[model samples]
Target: MENKKAIKLIDKILENLDATGINTDALIDDIKELRTYALEQQVPLVVKVLRLTYEHIEANQSFLIPILEDENDEELAEAQEVESTPVESLKYLIALTRNLNNKMNISDLREYKELLMAY
Candidate 1:
């Protein structure tokens, strides 16, 4: 069975990201709480992803833009294709967190981490 607690936490984080105006402090707090939970669960990959995500957002708060619900179809499509961007990488991480199978691709996470480091 999947860990419902983790899924709920991830969903909360995603919802915060989707909000019109993101409160950076709250987001960071949520990420830290999730990372602690992952560590307790002994999920190293999840912990790493959360740590990297926290760092990326902390360093680039001003540059971080939440994906809007009303964005044009073309822009959303473009965002999905441009995985190198930080925002897109974050979105990808959120998607990874929501995987029903509870299997996160390490390679993809590594790639996103590298991309985040580039900025």
Candidate 2:
């Protein structure tokens, strides 16, 4: 349930990015690349969040190293990073979900992503 909520939250962040004018095409490419990487390594979604979380932390100008730090902190940092995207990063969210590890339902996933990206 928590991971589901977090995923939705990421969708909202992406939406905001779009609204703000981020280069979504590039974001999509990045997500696709990430997904491919995840598949190749058989990594789970939570760990996939590792890259996004790291990106967010660096953007925040924090001095902490992702691999050496806390999980909760990483998740929150990734959530906050979602706020920095241009207008809406909805596409990125879609890409991430499409690459999920089969732990959650797709319908529920879309609903939250839609709701969060609504604004």
Query: Could you say which candidate leads in TM-score?
Result: 1
> Pairs clashing in candidate 1?
none
Q: Write one digit per residue (lDDT tens) for candidate 1, span 87-117.
A: 4446557667555254335555555556556
Would you estimate the TM-scores of all the predictions? Answer: 0.66, 0.28
- CA lDDT, every model vs. true structure: 0.63, 0.43
What is candidate 2's lDDT per residue for 4-118, written digit by digit as tens? Answer: 5445545654554556434444444444554454455565543345345335434543312111112458776676575534232334334345445554434434443333333
Off by over 4 Å in 1: 62-88, 100-104, 117-119
Q: What lDDT does model 1 reach?
A: 0.63
- Give per-residue lDDT, candidate 2, residue 96: 46
Clashes of each: 0, 19
